[model samples]
Target: MANIQYVTKEGLDKLRAELDHLESVERPKISQQIAEARDKGDLSENAEYDAAKEAQGLLEMRISKIKDQVANSRVIDASQLDSSKVSILSSVKIKNTANGMEMKYTLVPETEADLSKGKISVNTPIAKGLLGKVVGDIAEVSLPNGMEMKFEILDIKID
Candidate 1:
């Protein structure tokens, strides 16, 4: 079974647009390539045909994976989200307990996660630790470097 993924309405629309592009544009391009390759020579000795077939297989797999992602996706309403605690689509401000460094991150779906924009995926370790934590609560998160860090929730916003 595919894992459920939470996304905003805009994120869902982006996914749908990408899927539509892949189906309407990319799929035909691959089909055309296959057809052109097939017209070149016999199936037994044609390297181009083999390559096109492999490309088509990869394209199909990508399409299927995206389809599954879309199917399991759930849209999160930003306006209805509670700002009392950290959750998906919440923009949280936290301060590191050890270093006293402050940082803000928006917990979003994987598809919408952009490190440059300070958006972190809800499935990430830090975000998971922060989830359900309200202002003034501390969250202890394990990092990839085998170090544990503590962060104090300062603020939470849905928008």
Candidate 2:
């Protein structure tokens, strides 16, 4: 069974748009290339035809994967989210115990995650450790560097 992925409405729309583009734009482009290649060729020895066929197969696979993702996606209602504890769609502010530096991150679905924008994927180690933590709670998160860092939750917000 495919896993149900949580995403915002915007994220779901983006996926649908990409899938539509792949099906309508990319699919026809590949077909045209294949037809053009076939016009210049004998069946067994045409490198262009072979390459176009291979590219079409890969494009179809990507379209199928995107369709699956769209089918299994669940849109999260931001207004209905609880702010009592850290969770998906929650913007959390924390202070690093080791350096006393404060940072903020918004937990989002993998498709919507952008580190540069202060959004972290829910599946990430730090987000997983921070989930369900409340203000004044200390969380120990294991980093990719093989070191554990301690943080104190300062606030949680839905917006």
**Top TM-score hit:** 2
Which 10 consecutive residues of model 1 have the lowest summed lDDT? 74-83
Q: Write the per-residue lDDT of candidate 1 for residues 28-51, one digit (tens) a residue.
A: 998999899889879999998898
> Lowest summed-lDDT stretch of 10 residues in model 2?
40-49
Q: List the residue pairs that clash in candidate 2.
A: none
Tens digits of per-residue lDDT, candidate 2, 18-100, equal: 99999999999999999999999596999999999999999999999999999999999998878999999999999999999
51 Cα displacement, candidate 1 (Å):
0.7
What lDDT would each prediction earn against the true structure?
Answer: 0.93, 0.95
State model 1's lDDT.
0.93
- Once fitted onto the true fold, the runs of candidate 1 whose alpha carbons sit more than 4 angstroms away are none
Q: How far is candidate 2 from the true structure (C-alpha RMSD, Å)?
A: 1.3
Candidate 2 displacement at residue 158 in angstroms: 1.1
- Best-performing candidate as measured by lDDT: 2
- Badly placed stretches (over 4 Å) of model 2 are none
Model 2: residue 4 alpha-carbon error in angstroms? 1.3
